[model samples]
Target: MEDNIKDSKQLISEIQSQYTRLSKGQKLIAQYILNNYDKVAFMTACKLGETVGVSESTVVRFANTLGYSGYPKLQSALQELIKNKLTTVQRVEMSDDFSDENVILNKVLRSDMDNIRDTLDGIDNEAFQDAVSKILKAKKIHILGVRTSFVVAQYLGFYLGIILDNVHVVRMDMGDAFEQIVRVGEDDVVIAFSFPRYSKKAYQLVKYAKEKGASIISITDSLFAPIASVADNTLLVNNSMASFVDSLVPAMSVANALAVSVGMKEKDDIKDYFDDLERMWEKYGVYE
Candidate 1:
């Protein structure tokens, strides 16, 4: 229990580090817990085992592998950690009555604002600046995101392309992101966004980009996220402001900051890029 509260990342890393020592059943339980932490936090041993395709005794053994006295104790620690880290409104909305429209609106707004504040406090300035520098200096920038995160990535790619040359946003259903990432090199960078219930494809893209020598910047809910672990630099974003859904306000702000920082860093280059864009717009009659 003490170990679980120390650091979520360290807890998972320790388990992963010793994964080879775990029995087959324990490995199944470990994988389930790691992937469904939020769910396990609220589930009983029976329910957890049912989901993991293991028996209740196997689930208890898995907890013991983590040095817990029993499964209940492990669940308690997970509940406490999640309760402390997740925004209050997230829990409240899950069980509270939202019959009143005004009440719901106020709650959502307040929760989102709190999430933004928490995210700002959690951000590491040096790491953030380093990521920005990587993107700014790269010969090409690739942004990958899926599901809801796709919207944020698209917005970032659009603004970045306006301010920087060689910016590409990978759209959903686009064939083989890994194949696309093969085009990136040591002179390029990849910025990836993924949150809880992370996109496996996004993770693969990050891995492929890294293997190809492209620097990576990840924006995720915690350092425990797969993408965060692989990134050259990571920015933590708090998205648990709502129950079972992640808020995008904080991520959008982070994206905006990255774009503005890169723009300021290459002010002269951006000026020339926009000048060329203006000439093209005039020739194509894009706008009056």
Candidate 2:
């Protein structure tokens, strides 16, 4: 009974710890979540009830039975669990649930739309603005992302570089990538991009930057993400894994929004920069 709601523990462990206390209906819900947590994480309380052939009230009560304030909190915990822990097998299996069902088109697109909506609705404006302000004032900004996340880092750093004076995109291709960031110090900022099955190397790099006293801005899918754990500012963009392929729609959308926000702040500078570049392009006859 004591220390009942420790969300830090794995969802399965939490459920198992309380298994003896659950009623038959609650146990059914618990078993469903345990077996298919990847699927359950995205379901609404009402939908979850239907999946278990129980009433909506029962699902809510099951959450309480598991020591969550409500279904959303429990759902969030489940989501946090899978984002960084899902194995490749689990991912493909979960993805198969959709294509195998034969409603790939509608279900996949609808799920993407939901992820986009949730990302926008869930973001904190204050955190967004703080990230922008840090980028503007930092003596140098280092953007770190790898694997699937590298593209997002490249997109943000590319656009931000157009407006800002010193934006560096850190890539693993440098081989000695961390060496490129050795000069990170108090006046610097490092924005790290991490998502589902987050890169341990990326997290370690952020931790390194944090140790060097550079302010960290984490762009990730969950507050539980390793980068988020040490970040000075965290921007959450929901990316629910609807298929074997991780959805990048929300992450890309977030990157664009961030670029636009920073662009607005540096509008005059950006204009002048572009103006000069246009002259150079014309001088070279670069256009067809």
Candidate with best lDDT: 2
lDDT of 1 by residue, 1-288 (tens): 354334443566766776889989888877887787766776779988887788999988887877788886677556545653555455554433345776877867786998799789878999998998888788999998888899999999999988876899987777866667778898999999987567788888898889889999999877777798789999988775445456898999999999899889889988888898899999999997
Model 1 residue 281 CA deviation in Å: 6.7
Q: Among all windows of ten consecutive residues in candidate 1, which has the lowest summed lDDT?
A: 1-10
Q: What is the TM-score of each candidate against the true structure?
A: 0.67, 0.83
Question: Residue 130: error of model 2 in Å?
Answer: 1.3
In model 2, which range of ten residues has the least summed lDDT?
Answer: 1-10
> What would the TM-score be for candidate 1 when compared with the true structure?
0.67
Clashes of each: 0, 0
Poorly placed runs, candidate 1 (over 4 Å): 1-99, 272-288
Q: Of the candidates shown, which would achieve the greatest TM-score relative to the real structure?
A: 2
lDDT of 2 by residue, 1-288 (tens): 222223735668878888888888888898898899877876889988998999999999988877778888887777766667778786776564565566888888897999899888889899999998998889999998989899889989898888887989997887787898989998999999998788989988999999999999999987778899999999998887776677788888988888899899889988899999999999999996
Whole-model lDDT for model 1 versus the true structure? 0.80
**Residue clash pairs of candidate 1:** none
